[model samples]
Target: MKIAVITKTIITSFGLLILLAPQRTHAQLVPQPWVSVGGKDGDVTYSVGARALNWGAELGFGPDSATGFDLLKFLSLPVVSPYLGLGYYSEDKGLAVSGGVQVGAGDNLFLGVGYNSVRGINGQLGIKF
Candidate 1:
């Protein structure tokens, strides 16, 4: 248990350090690992990965929702990072929403659950610049 805590702390610290470090003029961006717990179409599904750049995506599976995939990234940032996500492989076909802060911290990650949402939880697993 202590080891796990320490590992998490170290990982978090590393992530924060990278986040706080000075930026390079042409440095590449990476994805951040993020996990979310929520429901879709009244069914539960959790996302467990992320990708960097404007061409990255995520993949995860759930019981009711089954296997799912998404292609989303920062498209617009007006006080919040707006993204375009397309989800499929669920009972209700798929969902399309394009007005959420899908990029960066301080943004809600647990926005979908127990409702008519597509992704119950989606993790941002890397950075992109």
Candidate 2:
């Protein structure tokens, strides 16, 4: 019941973003490559990923290591951009649902915090190209 409500909310939100994005001429799809290293279950885990447009994918490693693919939609907001993702984690853990906000520090730098159902919570510091 809760998951169904959340999924509906996300789909509705993304639909709105798609409908409204075309009105903004300055909007650009920036390709970003990122590396994240954090701990899961007291062991170090890492991921390397790339994002373009409203989609992203990563390969994660640790005790509960898995390859994950996600669809992310970023809100067009100043200072902070909020995003949400739903992914399948294939390996030791099954599925992962995550969401986070990216705060820009410079042209190519941002910081993020996210939670994954299979891996718990993690922080990410990444450089966007």
Candidate 3:
């Protein structure tokens, strides 16, 4: 009987702690949209992408038109956030691999440079809310 009472009290205390603790919203669910322009073999490629929760999806328009999806892993850093991603592109572009470092330009703006297997070296500009 004593053990049962103690268990109930502990559970109540934990529940109260959980209820009173600060609540954090998952901001990573908000997508960060970016535009990129790149060149390969004298042809220009334009692409747009959005990232959320360490995942990204992109659509490319230009010579090598394709749709791609990527899983992004970000490194914890001070000024710059560097990421590496592995993806697959449609339209015969095959496997896509990319790496980039993004630097915050201002409060809500970021700039990046990355290289994609199908898109070549690209510059990225994005905004985060």
Candidate 4:
């Protein structure tokens, strides 16, 4: 199906980007990780994700399982980052677009709110290392 091809392409592109990313002197022990919960059409969905080098990926499970990838850009402001994302869900749901903002709760904790065409509104909690 068309969705299968698109999914493969996206996975390949993300893999290439990771492989070609520049190396840095300091390394992170762990990427920023988060959990998200949302609902759509009375069904709830749960997802997990991680962010690093301005890029993030997530996987959702429940009534509408999906995989998502995003690019996060941090604003000049002290504690806010906004992101735009694309996701592939069940056959019926197909593709979805999402956007959100994340605010740093402190030095290591963060909170986020986002909306997805298929997943509806979500709240996220994460930790930065």
Candidate 5:
């Protein structure tokens, strides 16, 4: 199906980006923690995650509970960090694919808009610490 192909492409791209990242000792230990609250369709969803280098993972809860892994730091824009993610949710729902742009509000705050295949359109307000 189309979704399967897209998912494969995303995973492949993430792997390529990770392999291309610079080798830095400090980057491996630094964790960027964040909290996100949003709505998918009519269901409320929230997540907490951490990013280190170009990789991140989140535990999410809502109409469905899921765990997601994202490739962060792929784009080097000044104020916005764009990311792509893939996740597996409970119930019969399978893979969830997502992409979003995060805009920094301060040193530790960000706002984002994203769409997930399983979650619908979502707007997020988060704090990174």
Candidate 6:
């Protein structure tokens, strides 16, 4: 439904950016596509929102696999941006609140660390455009 549309839009936009501009795209390889996998030992719960200067949500993976969503802002800093987020995890019960910082190492390369309300700590590696 609406989720599919939004996903398509993002994909389309990213594709266009990749195709339309090669030099610039290769130089910045930003907003790179990424997915993360991790684990939490204790019981956990929380809800998350991820977008630039905005809040949002997802179904969540619960305790076992918490699919986290993060919002990346590039205006504040160069090579590094302020990261903010909230996510619904599976562990403790459900949703968990989280936030932190994101740093870009190079084109299509970056990593981040944030605090998870349920997991105690959360880490992620990502790419950008």
State candidate 2's TM-score.
Answer: 0.70
In terms of lDDT, the poorest run of 10 residues in model 4 is 68-77
Show the lowest summed lDDT stretch of 10 residues, model 6: 49-58
Candidate 5 structure quality by residue, lDDT tens digits, 19-92: 57564544435566676677766787777676666566766665656444433443435687677777777766
| TM-score of each predicted structure versus truth | 0.48, 0.70, 0.68, 0.68, 0.66, 0.47
Worst 10 residues of 2 by lDDT: 19-28
lDDT of each: 0.47, 0.66, 0.71, 0.71, 0.66, 0.46
Error of 4 at 112 (Å): 0.5
Superposed model 1: Cα runs more than 4 Å off: 1-28, 62-65, 76-79, 90-99, 103-117, 120-129
Model 1 local distance difference test score: 0.47
RMSD of model 1, in Å?
13.8
Minimum summed lDDT over a 10-residue window in model 3 is located at: 18-27
**For residues 1-129, could you state the per-residue lDDT of candidate 3 as single tens digits?**
999999989856654553344423453678888999988788887878877654566666545566666555554245676666667778888788777777888988888888777777889999987
Number of clashing pairs, model 3? 0
Instruction: Estimate the lDDT of model 5.
Output: 0.66
Please write out the lDDT profile of model 4 over residues 1-129, one tens digit for every residue: 999999989856754554455545353446889999988789897778887666677776546455444444322235776666777777477777676878999989999998878778889999988
| Tens digit of per-residue lDDT, candidate 2, span 20-124 | 553245554777777777666787767766666545666666455566665555664666766666667777566666666667889888787776665556677
Q: What is the model-wide C-alpha lDDT for candidate 2?
A: 0.66
RMSD of each: 13.8, 3.8, 14.3, 7.7, 4.5, 11.4
Model 3 CA lDDT for position 35? 95
For model 4, the superposed segments whose C-alpha errors exceed 4 Å read 1-30, 62-77
> Which model, 2 or 4, shows the larger lDDT?
4
